[model samples]
Target: MKRTLVIGDIHGGLKGLQQVLKRAKISEKDKLIFVGDYVDGWSDNASTIDFLIKISEKNNCIFIRGNHDYLLHKYLTKNDTNPMWVNHGGASSIKSYEHISEEKKQRHILFLDHLKNYYIDSENRLFVHAGFTNQNGIGNEFNPDMVYWDRTLWEMVCVMDPSSSKNNELYPKRLKNYSEIFIGHTPTTRIGKSTPQNFANVWNVDTGAAFKGCISVMDIVTKDFWQSDPVWRLYPDEKGRN
Candidate 1:
């Protein structure tokens, strides 16, 4: 079986991500899919983008756009002043590009623009940055907020919790299209601290790497999962040194 490796939010933790990939034993034949959030939170945003772009070019790698990625693209293109952007770990992303030339910045921006919102395979697995609404069908058109920051939808679908009120009736009716939906975005803590599960066939891989949690990678075919311990302190130096 062709192994499909789904990686969680990188959040610029290139070193940690490299170690995780090494541990996961990712091979050239394996299809690598990133759950997005490539920039911000960590010190190596520029290097992280460069690495992802190379992987995308060399092999079969799918990149999904996370909320942070959306914000970074906006900043790079329109130079928008979004305070929430900086608050949600965008400061580190800015710092990461401070030393880089304008040319490099443009390159990264272009790379982000090319990323897809989701990746669907023949095996009935849907790879998205966040997740689809269970109230709505998975075939529903992609909404930016739901695509980038829909934890409520994840909670509703992943846990099948009927207690929580549905905020947006605009969301999909249910997860009927795909057998499994992989997502990131909302921190796992917010998702209620627990390992990945198959509630309504929705799997959340965002182990909160940007906050106080691990970075996870799972092999879709083998169901093999690996994670790095919470490395929140890894960003204090800002020089990319451990």
Candidate 2:
């Protein structure tokens, strides 16, 4: 059956990404939606981008922009190496590209430049790298940065009163905008979960592939999912974003 798969944050773990893809039995017939942060952790940053670019040629995919992707774009296209970024796996991303050809680097830049801020599928499922703050919904977002940086949406959902009806005035209007929301920026590992998690209608697929956890991909319709081995095991020698 045709399926729409929502992928979680990769964080340069090309091996883990591959594992999940294969384990999930993904095919060209299925639509793949990457939630983002494809770089800036493991040693495979450049390779990860190359793989994504190459795979996109044969598979239907939607690439959403994440905070790390935007940061890497700044460094690649503008030479901005913000210290905080360097501290947060940016150095690893830079190292990965050190041996790459300028031609490939340019291609990577193009890929990064075209990443979408968010995607709403035909079923009204919202897919974004992070959270959006506008209670009125993503279409009316007041700040563009909020789409890729806000954590309030996820935080709110995590603490929301699940029994409250959408019609309740005290309920969050943001959650009411879509049938379901898929995001990645906030890893479920942070909350002590090493698997895809759902709170209200928001599903956080980021299982912390940037850290010691694994990568995840979920069939949005059936809610069935697949995961890779812990990323730390895949790149045992590296600290990744730990």
Q: Pick the candidate with the highest TM-score.
A: 2
Clashes of each: 9, 0
Looking at model 1, which ten-residue stretch has the lowest summed lDDT? Answer: 162-171
lDDT of 2 by residue, 23-59 (tens): 9999889899999999999999999999999889988
Poorly placed runs, candidate 1 (over 4 Å): 134-139, 142-145, 158-173, 191-194, 236-242
Tell me each candidate's TM-score. Answer: 0.86, 0.98
**What C-alpha lDDT do the candidate models reach, one value each?**
0.76, 0.93
Per-residue C-alpha lDDT of model 1 across residues 1-242, encoded as one tens digit per residue: 55889999888888778878888877788889998998787787889999988877766999998988989888888887599888777887877777889898889988988888788889878888876654455457565456676666676665555444335454344665666788888767665673444455677788777777778899886678988766565555553212
